[model samples]
Target: MITEQIAKDIWELHSRLFDHRPILQGHIRAFVKEFEEKRGTREEDRLNKIKTQLNDMTDKYIPETETALDTFLTNIQAKVKVAVEVCKKIEEKENNIEVGFLDLQRQRRREEWDVFMQEQFEKSAKVDQDMDIEMKKVSAEYEELEKKIEHISTATP
Candidate 1:
């Protein structure tokens, strides 16, 4: 009995082979190459010979173990399924690592900007403090000068 999974796998391979014609010229050539390999040497005699052999085998042996081929193909597909899942996991992890790298870069930039802004703010604050101290000294000197002029004017008068 042919299972549904076998049918689905066959459909997938058929679709890849027939329904989805590849876009690249190289891929088309590769397909032709593979077909020629399978069809035997681009010669009619070779193809006919292969056909006769296949027919002979089918007539002699295929009836006796029909399910064996299907089971073997299905088992190979099961192994392929595991490999595909592992490859998907590896791809996902690689994507996550790329995202993490970008995020880390952004974080470092943010921290650098914060440090630069903090340094600018500190410099501004220091300048303000120095201005305030200078203003106080100037005010005190101006007051003392005013009092001296007033005393000198009183004495002279």
Candidate 2:
């Protein structure tokens, strides 16, 4: 993208010079030629310096960013895993309580209530699992974007 823009800018500069053809005739062309050569050399040097700076910036950030991402992912994964386990344990305890209540109400018509409660518990578990999965996917995508941003910032002047 930067290359294309640079090419377009150069073309526009050339076109502007040609548009004033009469004014740029004879000695004017020689003078413009010298000026352009000097400008081109200066621009090249500037671009090289900018490229070096970009390289240095990228070198400074890449490893630090990678380490940060790795640490973040590990922390999030560990926390999520712990949360899911705790949630599962809580769900099991709730299920056991429901079962015990159902047993006590076995003589009564509580079948519908038992079924509804079980269904709700299952739905809640499913929702929790889905949310965790979504969060993991989002985290992965964020990491990828970070990498892409770093690559683009480094590659472009």
Candidate 3:
């Protein structure tokens, strides 16, 4: 799952050697050109290491996230399935709602289960949304990193 800490870490790491923020007027492509034109060979190894880490961010960490999110989403789906099954057992046809038929015991149970499912759904949705946002940020950073690496690669000669 894409925890808040991981998201923050991802942004922090990307910010170390490059700027990954919104651009208002200046062009990133032009900035890369200027960077390449001005870059010196004083610390080539450090630059290479940074490049490698960037690559790993896309290759290793991103895929690992996919697996983690897949598992997380699967678990959430299971919870939803259980909720649906339990909801089906409820005989109530309350319009625009999912509650059990009005027997004292069943009604109380219905309210509890409905509330539980609503909370689960909301929580799942939030996590999914956050994961998607992080994934987008990672993708944009990876692409920008690739551009920088290519510039460095060609400009070195």
* Reference-based lDDT, each prediction: 0.90, 0.92, 0.84
* TM-score top scorer: 1
Model 1, 38-126: lDDT tens digits are: 67755878778999999988997887577787779899999999999999999999999989999999999999999999999999999
Worst 10 residues of 1 by lDDT: 17-26
Segments of candidate 1 deviating more than 4 angstroms: 1-95
Name the TM-score of candidate 3: 0.34
lDDT of 2 by residue, 1-157 (tens): 9999999999999988767766658779889899999999999999999999899878988878999999899999999999999999999999999999988788465777888899999999999999999999999999999999999999999
Measured with C-alpha atoms, the lDDT of residue 128 in candidate 2 is: 100
Reference-based TM-score of each model: 0.40, 0.31, 0.34
lDDT of 3 by residue, 97-120 (tens): 533334666878989999999999
Candidate with more favorable, higher TM-score: 2 or 3? 3
Model 1 error, position 117 (Å): 1.5
Off by over 4 Å in 3: 1-102
Candidate 2 deviates by what RMSD?
39.5
Superior by TM-score: candidate 1 or candidate 2:
1
